[model samples]
Target: MPLPGTKSRDAALIAEFRMISGASEKIASSFIKKYKSTEAALDAWYNDPASANGGTSTPNKGQEKKLGEIWEKYKDSSDPKLVKIDGTLAICEELGVDPGSDSVLFCLAADLDSKVTGEWEKEPFVKGLASYPGNIDSLTSLKNYLPALRKKLNTDPTYFKKVYMHTFTLAKGQDFGARTLQLDTALDLWTLFIPPALTSSPSALQRTSDQTPPQFAEEEFDLWIEFMRKKGKAVSKDTWSLLIDFIRSIDKDFKEYDDEGSWPSTIDDFVDFVRTRRSSK
Candidate 1:
């Protein structure tokens, strides 16, 4: 009693659900039955208009006005010698926000956009607060606004890792190491991950609610195996065990590799040196 193309459409929908959810065929089939199509399912779950505060698209004008009022009070003074970054940081501090936080960075950037060039500057910064998405006009409203935005954005749990790496390139500080603690604190608020270790205090451990063991990407493990084989070492569980130890050690003393922003760091270089001096049996 099936329609001519019903089987194909159902098959395609099931496949799409599997790809999107990484769920098994049985689970994806259940989802497909309930939603009918991938697009509908995604939209219903992610962009639920009912949950989006009555589907208001633009920033709330009343909140924007409140933010604008605050901006006028804290807009940069006409002192040529005062660094703009310093002024921005001071204003964020007054608002009880971490100046280096991604939320602050995004909100401040939006708040400071210039009308002429759409660049973050003093005048437009005040004007931009009247907008939605990243409005930081008022700390009081932010308590409610941020949660709503987070739901809208569907922010991934691992988003902070990207933020963490991006900061190194974006930040314009010579001694960034000194402010590493601030970065850790700020990133911890936005993402859920137990850092392998904290360089600031080697003994300090950050455990997540799940308390599950750290998960390594398949490619990371592959690279470890490749590196060992290239050095003419026998690939074994012991070798992987050593590499895991190395990874933990690297995380514990990240400051040592903080100078280089590359993944796995100079840990390989150190490993290579040790390998060279080893006596071949």
Candidate 2:
């Protein structure tokens, strides 16, 4: 089960993710209900972080029957889209907001993942992973079901993955400004959250040129003044978002990364180290 104080927060996070990503609350609530119920079987997911396969390839009709009943009732509801609860677990693992944290955002992450998958955008989270707060090993893998409900996504995402590799890159940001990412990245100035799959390894944003990507580099106090002189927007939301993500990247994962015993005990530490390197360099 999620930690004691986390249930309501889960609701809120899912709600926020829903609003931002265009999901509905009713559907989020159902997911939480299922996640919390048979948690023991699934909770280990957090500690292990490697079992995020979306659907059981082999027959598991016993569990499927139980999950299908819920899917059948709510799947058709117009209030919100819902996948079979089991189908969602793998995606939830990748998204990382324990089904029980601030619901407002989980809903959004859920919807966002679904929409990204439905539209056949590069589904980064499909095989990504994250550490849950209380999980023993602090990691979980994520994947998608083979056949998705949305007809648009009937085609495999293998193509979308190629598009991501083909399109987004060092030059695009320079030519387009940060706005090129408006649709592709889930940037929120408010919560300082980014999809863990995409957000990890802040250093990964380094420019193809010797110079660092302007966004990942901390804006020195001097640059702030210069931008002010140039009448640049002092608080462009993206800048604010980058700033918040910087802080959160440190705050959430710093301990695991910077410790001199410093060897990464697990995957989280390795990812955290990537974030710290981005902030410092």
Candidate 3:
């Protein structure tokens, strides 16, 4: 028989443990009672596998069911298998995220392993959620996890690069035949991806201070945007992807830039633009 009040207070504990560890009800109950918390129980299960008995660290039936329910709830009504922009917006609303904020939206997309900007397929949705650490069986849990996900994006450079590269594809939309991103769109995306401090908006600065250090100063990003407005027609895939590399490799004053290096002509032109502005000042 289940322990007293297990149906009330301890239910979430058992469910989370079972979801992460793939333990049976009896096993989950035993571990919870022994360890006293979901994190502790999971720690014991992973650090000392014998304590888990036969429970495997994999998604179990319960997780699948819960994920399925969430999918059905958020999936596009017309397509049933896709979470379209409307569905995506609903999710953003639930999570208290601004759909207009590409920085946070892109991070969320990375977490969901989204393949498109406005659409999410069932497979990636299920696999991403199933593989995500911590409990995300409900929207509430997923919302609670967003801070950690954002922190990872801010702190983990490699992971941030993955999301950054992925954003190029997402921003391009479903036009597979297109080879370049629109200049206006690229400018908007750069503002979001580069760092919130670039905008000099009070809210963005606050967010930037709370997160990672800025990769480039506000003046640098502003100059780049100004140069783009003057000379850029469209942003090729190479330019779009290499901009991050440029920011990381070059200093704010362009002291480290090598004209002989393999930077794209667009970046080369921007450097020239910067030099001309500096010499005239």
Best prediction by lDDT: 3
Worst 10 residues of 2 by lDDT: 145-154
149-263: candidate 1 lDDT, tens digit per residue: 3222222223323332333323323443342323333234323222322211111121233322323333333444445445553222233223334443343223333334433
Model 2 per-residue lDDT tens digits across residues 58-144 = 324443353334334334234244543444554355545354432223322332343322121122222111111111111121112
Candidate 3 regions exceeding 4 Å error are 1-57, 197-215
Looking at candidate 1, the ten consecutive residues that score lowest on lDDT are 198-207
lDDT of 3 by residue, 78-174 (tens): 8987989998888888889887874767876776778788688876777666655553577777676566455445444456677777888888888
TM-scores for every candidate against the unseen true structure: 0.36, 0.24, 0.72
Best candidate according to TM-score: 3
Off by over 4 Å in 1: 1-53, 79-86, 98-137, 143-158, 173-213, 216-267, 270-281
- Ranked by TM-score, the better of candidates 1 and 2 is 1
Q: After superposition, which runs of candidate 2 have C-alpha atoms over 4 Å from their true positions?
A: 1-45, 49-59, 77-113, 116-281
By TM-score, rank the candidates, best first: 3, 1, 2
